[model samples]
Target: MSAQFIEKYRENAEIYTGSDICKQKSKELLLEINMPNGLLPMDDIEEVGYNRSTGFVWLTQKKPIQHRFTKIGKQVSYDTHVTAFVENRKMKKLHGVKAKEILIWITLNEICIDDPSSGKITFGTPTGISRIYPISAFEVEEDEKK
Candidate 1:
């Protein structure tokens, strides 16, 4: 049957025929969201730390930019935030930057970072896992700063 009675039962029709596996729900979808803090190997993270209990590398979330940019009036515009974890303080010291500088560095490098010297953004993240949210979403946490 061609499912002419589907509307009566509120069923829908979507046709995609390529692989039979595509029609099946992912087994991974049922798995728990237990993403742990660990450095993505390709991230080229420096200053590795040791934890006797667990072998997990400490990692931080980084937003990746996946759009284009342009000049608006006299200011530059961007569409994404690139973020990630720095392995340790030594990485910062080696880069000659303090804690505050690191955060600013992320924003600065949101587009393309090309500083050849120490102040350049040295580390990289897994690329696609960076958090990309609207600035208004930060409102709830902003109140805590004051």
Candidate 2:
């Protein structure tokens, strides 16, 4: 993220540094917001920040990475910096994330579980395109320390 962007949101935000802490914090935030913990799967996270009052969250990593959700057969790319405004069951105004659709990469702007009971989750794009998939498709097993 740009220095100005970080400065504007860093005030009063809960910030955590280090890969381990950042990874844990990211998973915790996702669970708190009713999203799947495996949705991110970012590697080597350097920092994580969350501003409760504004519902803004940001994550910084050493480098960009692309991960494939094997269960769902989809590939998604995450940038070095990712930011979003999160709320219960929803994340909006997201930046720095994209999902590959066939041969094209679609920028994802929103993700929400409209009704938990429906067992569905929706991924939306800025251009009004969206796809709903079974929530189980994104569920992942937590890492077990060896």
Candidate 3:
């Protein structure tokens, strides 16, 4: 059932990139990134994009996007973007000071496998594969007007 919710990326014609997948571990990863220490309940997530040429996959949540008030009373929400992994916490250093607490930047590490025939996706089974970093923020101007 979970597999039905995932988006498929076709590599050639017969093989799917298998970037977006619906699995327990993938859900947990999204939940951990969304909330640290499991403080907030995990919401459903769906994959956004997969670059078959570069082997990159982007993720997003299925739940309603939440917005917050700015210091100037304007309502805005964070736009998340995942970048390549760096060991020295590059993302945190660059954005840690400006990013909000709810906005988390994390270096994701995992080996994903795609089943061309069955359309099943699999990731490495290790707890520490994904790590959380600081949150990055960019206000949506359109949202602020609404």
Best by TM-score: 2
**Whole-model Cα lDDT per candidate?**
0.20, 0.92, 0.28
TM-score for each of the candidates: 0.14, 0.95, 0.24
How does candidate 1 fare on TM-score? 0.14
lDDT of 3 by residue, 1-146 (tens): 12222233324311222333422333333333332221112234444333334433333454433344343332322233222221111211111111223455232233222322442222221234432222222212223223
Candidate 2 has what TM-score? Answer: 0.95
Q: How accurate is candidate 3 locally (lDDT)?
A: 0.28
Residue pairs with backbone overlap in model 2:
none
Select the stronger candidate by lDDT from 1 and 2. Answer: 2
Query: lDDT tens string, model 2, 61-120?
Result: 999999998878999999998999999999999998999999999999999999999999
Question: Considering summed lDDT, which 10 consecutive residues are worst modelled in model 3?
Answer: 89-98
- What candidate 1 gets wrong by more than 4 Å, as runs, is 1-33, 36-103, 106-146
Model 2 residue 63 CA deviation (Å) reads 0.7
